[model samples]
Target: MKQWWIIICMILSPCLKADNLFIEAESFDKKGGWVLDNQSMGQMGSPYLLAHGMGVPVENASTLLQVREAGEYRVWVRTRDWVKQWDKPGSPGRFEVLLNGKALRTTFGTEKAVWHWQDGGTVLLKVGENSLELHDLTGFEGRCDAVFLTSSLDLLPPDGGNELADFRRKMSGLPAEPEEAGEYDLVVVGGGMAGCCAALSAARLGCKVALIQNRPVLGGNNSSEVRVGLSGLIASQPYPNLGNLLDEFGVVGHWNDWEAKQDPSSARSKQIREILQRHPEKKIHNAGPATNYEDEKKQSLLQGQENLSLFLNMQVYDLRKEGDRITFVIGKSIISGKEYIFRGRLFADCTGDGEVGFLAGADYRVGRESKDETGEPRAPLKADRLVMGTSVQWYAEDAPDRSGFPDCPWAIRFTEETCVPATRGDWDWEAGLDRDQITEIEYIRDHALRAVYGNWAFLKNQSSKKEQFAGKKLAWVAYIGGKRESRRLLGDIVLREQDLLENISYEDATFTTTWGVDLHYPKPIAGMDEEPFLSYCDVQEIKPYAVPYRCLYSRNVGNLFMAGRNISVTHVALGTVRVMRTGGMMGEVVGMAASLCKKFDTYPRGIYEMYLPALQTLMRQGVGKPGFPDADKLD
Candidate 1:
């Protein structure tokens, strides 16, 4: 009877044959310029790869696959023709797939708008390691999600939605629930300068912290990836030690010296040139110090902390909430496709987009508020959709000889009158303020790229000063767009512009914002052709004002804390507090609050209401490096 039962089980079991191979494009071993874009996951089904060709075809992305069986297998790729949604003609993004050393006949990035599997003819594979490469044919932003290889020729890949997610999980052999990562006192999402400071401060205060970042590097906007300089004041009156962490991690000198009141041909230019010559490897065209060593220094500091566990290239997508508190967060490794379940007593939403708070049903606001709502003079009369735009900064280097640039007819056209004849695309080159900053990030980024390519082409080919630019070659253009504003999580006290203008002081004041009410709007240039990408700044300077602790934690979410640009503030007030230095101070204050939470075994509201004195004590003591010189101050 036992022998008969064993034979029957063997006959009925479905795991007798070999499984097919599935490779997620974002998990490729070598992903050159192609970036992992997960912003549109809700609409696209899953995170995918974006070539982000800023007018030039980026490098190819390749991955190695170890075949289990030597046999013929059919190939299918999940992709979409992105521009097709606009009802536009011609596919801007076109690319081919290479197997081993040969190219597949089927070209990708030319399909319909909706994501679906495009069939690539069957190919023979040997029982060994095979090379798969995404060869980009155009410098025009090709994209892919995953590649599916199956022995059965008739097997169709899942279309999309939850089914596609399930298919990916099954093929990748991932469990339904993510593997237990570990318990932590605080889990801080986003590895921007603010998040970094928060994690470091919490760890210093004896809390086991998990710092999860979507990108490979720390310092979101200030990192080499985005290259925006830190602004606003640090180590101001109320809290002298608040920005010690910022000073330890920030670049020493000012970046926009040419834009200052001083003349461009001053001795400062010569001094800067000499400094650049000393470090030729760091030659960044108009941008000073392409890579900041301070980021590396901060990463080292975080790693040295025994209580803080840093997880790079991990994007937190979902959270498990028990009532108002977040029990755990689910993050997927961008390179390995492995899910990590980060359990924690408290969570910090330092993500500039306020994504974690949005996921947890925290009250938030986006775009501008009306005069009736905010009661600020700067507020719009009838709050229309207008938010601060993102910047895609670029620069060019003067070659020894003449350099030729290809005419990008696919890009938005720019005439001589509409072109910006500058070598560097600085802070003023901003766009996408009218659209959804978070949901339409890819579009915003691509539009900025189009503006850059179009303007450059005009300068090289049609402008009267073409002779002057003939020897210049485009050196660098940031594919990772530096966003300015997004969803601001609502807190107990929504800091208003009146608070700063009137110099109202709160008893729970932690940090001071020194920047002016700097807002951005489209510049009115003569003979403008398309949507103006370049923005003009409108500044309303005010004295440095203290930001209160009540604006650091979510009002509704029990254990939620926030920092960075997403902290509770009116649009007018955000104009002053959104800068990196001020945001870093906010992170410092939240870190102190987190420590108090751990000490008292309470939530964020509890710290604000019942244990305010304890938090104030920590603020007075400060959590930064002891005896650090107060070099950074508000003028």
Candidate 2:
């Protein structure tokens, strides 16, 4: 693995002085309807604006630019043909770069599959402020990273390399040194359930904490952007209050068909209605709607905290380390290219991909473990990179009028034989099972998009039951891929599936996990061979078992603590512990341990070695208010 110091200098670098005129699409004053997507910034080189209009073209995004050299400058847009990788037919991501109310001659996003500078010929710029617009032709998913304008046509921006990275620093006029974002007692990365709980717990315990989230919202998969419902049982057995923090902020657990609940003719509708009758809070469901996730509630909780500070749209690319301990971390705002340097005492790797641990050179494992290695029955014979897939969940709803959907020849083609005839695609609509979940995530997400649009196009146009779908239009499709498994940061004890199956107990056990060991595999469709778009799962049920405290903190990296799916566990054990609720409980335990670290003046391991009793007391008492069904009970 490349050291964090060497790899992330481009993104980590920030500046305020620039000789060249460069317009980052993310910095656009009026985004209109385009969304800022920093999820694939590492691979694509920078965060970009995504026009996710479902099937309808979105309103144009515009920004005013001040040009010092007002003249005919060669225009270049950083974009790509999103579906060109598979040699697909049409360009779904095609868009135009406009200058001062006039569209450019060349159409962008119709060229290379990889991120490249598409020449828009030359455009005239005013002496003062000029109106720049990104006109989206098709809202399928048009992306624009940055727009460059130089007097010299020969001076083309390098596609992607160390040179291009350095050029970005030069063009952005960012200074070499980073601005300080203040020191903290605890720093929690990744604003998912685990990170949120970790920050909340630590903050409530009177530790000045910093919670950094790449996206604008808090919850990762469970956020409105992704819309995955929280799963697994919370508040189980000893230290029942471990998950109590979740209750303070509403984290919905139930996963019922949202549409079916509203349908009087549907069988499950009655059951759903009855559930809601008893508890109106049961309105939440997987991929239900944007309102179902209640992102604002989570945001309010984080903002209301006295000791906790929230840093949204700040993606941490690199960290500074003193020996084994991380001294500070460098994160840049996705919107403004300014750097944020957070110095902290103890750091938590709640980033589900184990990003902090990976950057810190902590011992970690990716993919499945061999059966011989873990002695687990479910472990594969040979170790392989077959981790669980990423889900781009989608759903369609009845439109006010008969809706029209364009043919998606550029997307994955589907026929009656291969198509999944359903209005809503759930967790099973997964892709990139065989690909690297980290490096190749853009492809993974795009593959899922191709499958979704292709299937939707078929269902809307060519399916035998096309009349049944004529009234329905695509409502919401998650752009942010909800990941299941990734890099597992290794710790003092690597929990195995056999431990839960055999009901093994640990003296230092902290949080309890009750989710089944559910692992996903490709569904094996008839026609799809290039990339499987659907998946099936093999669920191995496990009793509520407490995870050892040793699994929470890193074995090699001294001050780091981990939660979420990235915790120290074999592929088999990740099945049970990967669920959001289980991960949240882990966060609660981690937070309690973090407070202990500050109090005893010790690291994460030292808390276990010297002050395990203190952590236990904190867990038993808990941080959240009781009687709200205990930490919003994930199950």
Q: Which candidate number would show the highest TM-score if scored against the true structure?
A: 2
> Number of clashing pairs, model 2?
7
Taking the candidates one at a time, how many backbone clashes does each contain? 1, 7
lDDT of candidate 1 vs native? 0.80
lDDT (Cα, 0-100) at 333 in candidate 2: 90
Clashing pairs in 1: 57-139
Q: How many clashes show up in model 1? A: 1
Per-residue lDDT for 290-346 in model 1, tens only? Answer: 553356766777888879999998888899899999999999887767889999999
TM-score of 2: 0.93
Per-residue alpha-carbon lDDT of candidate 2 for residues 425-535, written as tens digits (9 for 90 to 100)? 889988888989989988899999988999899989999989999999999998999999989999999999889999999999888888789999987788666579889
lDDT of 1 at 219: 84
Off by over 4 Å in 1: 1-19, 32-35, 52-58, 68-72, 85-90, 250-288, 524-526, 626-635
